[model samples]
Target: MTLMKAVTFRDFGGPEMLQLTEVARPEPGPSDVLIRIHAAGICYHDVLSRAGKIPRDKPGQILGHEIAGEIAAVGSNVSPDRIGERVVIYQRLFCGQCPYCLAGRQDLCRNSRVLGENGGGGYAEFTCVPAQNAIQMPDGLDMTTAALAVCPIGTSVRAALGVAKIGPGDKVLVTGSGGGLGLHQIQVAKSVNAHVIAVTSSDEKVDVIKQAGADEVIISPDLKFSREVWRLTAKQGVDVVLENVVTNTFGESLRSTAQNAKVVVLGNIGTRPVEVDPGLLIVRRIRIAGSGNATYADVRRSLHLLATGAVKPFIGRVLPFPDVGQGHALMEQKAVVGRVVLSGW
Candidate 1:
């Protein structure tokens, strides 16, 4: 009956709904490992969960998906060697018996239970998870940076490599290029030797995106911006457009992509219906795809890339665990430059 401090929300609303409370520490099962959470990266999905945008089957749920910590204890059947090892957690817990899991696509498992959505999440002093979801952290990686591996880096890995199959010399345009995932997408594209054009809404993020290895950066949602993308590519447009914005930016992304190029939509920040000409898809042969959370392979590859120093994550600010509501407020206001991590639980 040991008690641990955790952030919880009973009825979904705004940041005010988030509350700090003491809860029972979870006991690890035979194949589970208990972790002392060092940091939890706040994401937009967490905001949506708090606002009731993402449905919750139960009440008083804790809401943080991206987590990084050290293994504190393990079940009797688990290996003792893992204790005290630093690790990044994979948010999605899948049923190994599902067809999707059998095909190595555990991200799409029908019965999958995401960490924050299913039960106890990372916004706690302690969390218990399956040993399979624990990924070893390389030396020199800190908790704040490790927390991003599960969401931002993992999503970029899934979209850029797993779905888009972006290759060397590929011309890629990343919309919403100033945000957490956008910056990671730029790094991932650069790692593959792709020429990256980052599109953002403010001039403030221009230099930031450029320093992250973007070949070019543009202010978004302007037809002139599309023209600039074409001009940069010698009027041929880009091979792939990472469309994370949901408003007119989506259409602009579609317009900026080269003939037969692919557009991968990952976010719904704008969250509005868009109009598209059917002829554009029919004649230009553009492909539109949706990507979600990372697979086990994606998580491993992302961590490996992070370990190799290929992807350096931009951490905006770190708030104390008790101030998770303030962190959420910063996120809602779009006040952060990169990932916002919560620490000192």
Candidate 2:
């Protein structure tokens, strides 16, 4: 059996749990493809998995979801042309036979399994994924940007376009606008020619948030920015609110939206309970939607945007594979501005 270096953890804990060691290189099964990972983007979900917030079937799991690489080998059922092609792996594992999968809504498939939570993830030199999940990379795209194209970019596409139904001339407000998802979401909103108002707790991130195409940047240390948003829109409020900080900013997000507006909830960073007023929802007529995972179509659209230079990838730090733990630490501390990618695996 051939061995490859992987970052593995036996018990769910903190950054100290991550261990760099040799593990058996996975072989491609029928209808699967073995990829030599060139770059793996770090996400908050990976941090949650390491902290035991996300469940695992067993111990000793390689944890990473955002991945981009070259197809080293293919299964018997896959085409030979796929070999040596650079590609990005769609993070969700879904059963293609399901109804949702047939409808191109694999993000909602009942038989879905998340990459890092299911089995071997992208924290290794080599990983095997379903052949359908391997999307061919465009000519000018690099592996690092390709890895970020899916989640921060593609997922944001789904949330802004598909879920929120953002349109031209609409006013969109994005909370937690300094992080990976928040920064990309601002650009996604701008792609539709919408007026984007970005909110962040850190003053140091205001310049980068503005650089990411936010029409208005709000530095709110108290996580209360609805009044500022109201003032920015001349008291009418925004048409859409991309709610990234659910726990800290949910109530304010509702308050920041216009009447009959859509509020798309990405994820809860605080992971705590929130108190919402029923009267507020009744009066504002706000629709609260929970965005699911990104689909193949979403990934393709985002890649096109990136290839055409309409959107740029934000790589805050590129760390060697051996320093994976350090990447997690920086992410935990919220020191890094954008995506943290691991290379040289």
Candidate 3:
């Protein structure tokens, strides 16, 4: 029996719960491929899971989803020639026959499951995923950059370009603008010629958000930035808003939009519910959309953007495989500027 090293939590409470363990090496199924993971991105989602917030991440389960690697082995049904291919893993295992998948909107696939929560997660030395979930890495793109393609990058693409449909000269406001998703979404919004206003709770991240292409940065530690947003836009407000910090800033995000603004809620950093003003929605004709995940096409677009230098990935720190707990600590403290990517087994 072959054993591989993986990071798993015996109990979900603290970063210390994440411990290295030897586990059975996973073998690919008939339609899957075994990948030798080179990089796995540590998201806030992982930190939440460690804190017992995400129920899908069971105790003792491997916990990382953003992954990039080389195809080391192919399943019986997969072509042997595909081995040695460098690829970025798509996080969801979507059933192709689902109605959403049939419409090429697999982002909403009902039968889909997230990789880290439901399958062979990437915290280990290797992981097995369906053959179709592997997206070829663009030429000259490194593993670390590819690791973020499907997550913050692709996710931002889906929210800004696809869901919000941001266009040239559109006014875009991004909440949590210094976060992993915000850094990339700023660039995505700018790529479409939008004027971006970045909002962050930390003053330390103000300059970082501007460096990431925010036309304006608002340091709103108290989560009240709507007034500044309105003043900056000359009372016009923004045309689109990408709300990455929903739990704390949903009301402000809604209040900071124009008459017919499109607001895309990317995540609720904390899972707690927020109070919504239905009157504000009715008066402004505000359209709020929630994106659970990105489509395969969004991942492909993110890769192309990365390759062409349209969107540069921001990695706060890169840790070795065994130091994954450190990444979680940094995330919990909100000390990382962008993302924490783990590499070097």
Candidate 4:
């Protein structure tokens, strides 16, 4: 029996529940490929899953979705030529037969399952995934940075560019600007020459957010940033709002947007119900869109951006896989400024 190191959780309460254990290595099916993970990006989703906030029925599940690795083995049906290729795993497992998948919108696949949300997660030495889900990493992109290509970069790209339709000379506002996705979104919005305003709750993140190319950084301790935004934009309001901390900031984000502006909701860290009054929407004509998981096309564009040096990754810390619990603890405490990557399992 082949054994591999994995961070598994049999209980759901806190970061202490994540245990380092030896588990049987998974084998690839005919259309699957086995990857030896080099780096896995820790996300807020993993923290929520550990706390039993995300829906999960079973225990003993590994909790990592952003994986970057080299192909260790390929199934009999897969091409042997793909062995040793560096790749990043797309965050979702989609059924190819779904209507959404057929329309090149796999992000909306009805039968899609998020990698870490169920099982066969990435917080391990080895993980088996469908050959189609493994995208080759672009040259000059390291494994550690590529690990974040899916969630932070790809998702933010979909939110800022695809959903919000950001363009040159546009005024863009980003909430939770110190987070993994927030940092990447700042860069994405800047890539097209948009004026970027970043909002963070912590004063410590103000400098870092400014360094990420934000034109202005606001420390909004009470989530009342719309007034500042209104003043900054000269009462015209911003053209788009990348709402990452949706539960707490959604209403204020809407108030900070110009007429017909789009508010793209990427994350809801509070995991609480949002209060929205439709009257504001009718008067402002603000469009609110929920940007879900990244599509395959989004990941491809993210890799291209990373390869071209258009967007740089901001990782707060990189720890050995045994310290997965510590990474989650930092996330739960909101101490991490950016993404926390785990390696060396």
Tens digits of per-residue lDDT for model 2, 93-113 = 899988889999989998888
Q: What TM-score goes with each of the models? A: 0.96, 0.98, 0.98, 0.98
lDDT per model vs. reference = 0.88, 0.90, 0.91, 0.91
lDDT tens per residue, model 3, 1-345: 889999998997999998999999999999999999999999788788778887766788898889999999999999999999999999988899978899989878889888888547999999999999998997899999899999989999999988999999999999989999999999999998999999999899988898889999999889999999999999999999999889879999999999999999888888999999999999999999987577889999999999999999999999998999999999888989999999997
What total of clashing residue pairs does each candidate reach?
0, 0, 0, 0
When 1 and 3 are scored with TM-score, the better candidate is 3
TM-score of 2: 0.98
lDDT of 4 by residue, 1-345 (tens): 999989898788878888899999999999999999999999898888888887753568888999999999999999999999999999889999988999889999988888978777889999999999999998878999999999889998888888888999999999999999999999999988999999998999998898899999989899899999999999999999998899889989989989999988888998999999899899999888889778888899989888998999999999999899999999888899899999896
lDDT of 1 by residue, 271-332 (tens): 55788878888887999999989998888888888889999988889999989998889888
The 10-residue segment of model 3 with minimum total lDDT is 111-120
TM-score of 1: 0.96
Clashing pairs in 1: none
List the candidate 4 regions with Cα displacement exceeding 4 Å: none
Taking every candidate in turn, the Cα RMSD to the unseen true structure, in Å, is: 1.6, 1.0, 0.9, 1.0
In angstroms, give how far residue 7 of model 2 lies from its true place.
Answer: 0.1
Ranked candidates (lDDT, high to low): 3, 4, 2, 1
